[model samples]
Target: DVKVTQSSRYLVKRTGEKVFLECVQDMDHENMFWYRQDPGLGLRLIYFSYDVKMKEKGDIPEGYSVSREKKERFSLILESASTNQTSMYLCASSSSGTGGSATNEKLFFGSGTQLSVL
Candidate 1:
């Protein structure tokens, strides 16, 4: 089965520290995405890479960036972690298959990275 793995399930850091969140997918998927899940705000995209060395900013790409040098590995970088950034972050990927469109394929997600900043 395809699985997405996040570097951490929980993390706490002081304000202004930089943070790196790693995500790896077992499936040879070409699309990877990062999103922050907040209580009332729902999942907001940060960044996404459709192929290695190529990326695009999502809806809420401010204060964040992404890397996808390898086919199966993608990374999310928080330039300066702040208290307001504390939230549940999820990494996901998709591959073409029985599903009609990429969206229909559905994203396989990592449990999530719960970041806490103080």
Candidate 2:
């Protein structure tokens, strides 16, 4: 079975601290994504990578950056954590679909990392 594992299920940091969120996928997926869940905002995409060393900024990438140095690993970095950034971070991996169409892709999601910034 495919599995997406997040390094931490819960995290807390100060307002100005730097944060790292790690994710790994057992399956050799070509696409990896980072998203954050908020109360009314739903799931907002922060970053995504379609291949090793390739990354693209998603809808809300202002305070977040991603690293995809290896095929199976993707990391999300919060340069300076803020109170408004406290939310549930989710990591997902999916196989690249034919013709690069996302409609046929199935994503495997991690349990999530709940971060609290104070």
Candidate with top TM-score is 2
User: Candidate 1 — which pairs collide?
Assistant: none
True-vs-predicted CA distance for residue 54, candidate 2, Å? 0.3
lDDT for each residue of candidate 1 in 1-118, tens digit (9 for 90 to 100): 8899999999999888989999999989988999999999999999999899999999999889888999899999999998889999999998755546555568899999999999
TM-score of each: 0.93, 0.94
Q: Which pairs clash in model 2? A: none
Residue runs of model 2 more than 4 Å from their true location after superposition? 99-104
lDDT of 2 by residue, 23-97 (tens): 999989999999999998899899999999999999999988899999999999999999999999999999987
List RMSD in Å for every model shown. 1.7, 1.6
- Model 1 poorest ten-residue lDDT run: 96-105
The candidate that wins on lDDT is: 2
**What's the distance in Å from true for residue 56, model 2?**
0.3
The lDDT of each candidate is: 0.92, 0.95
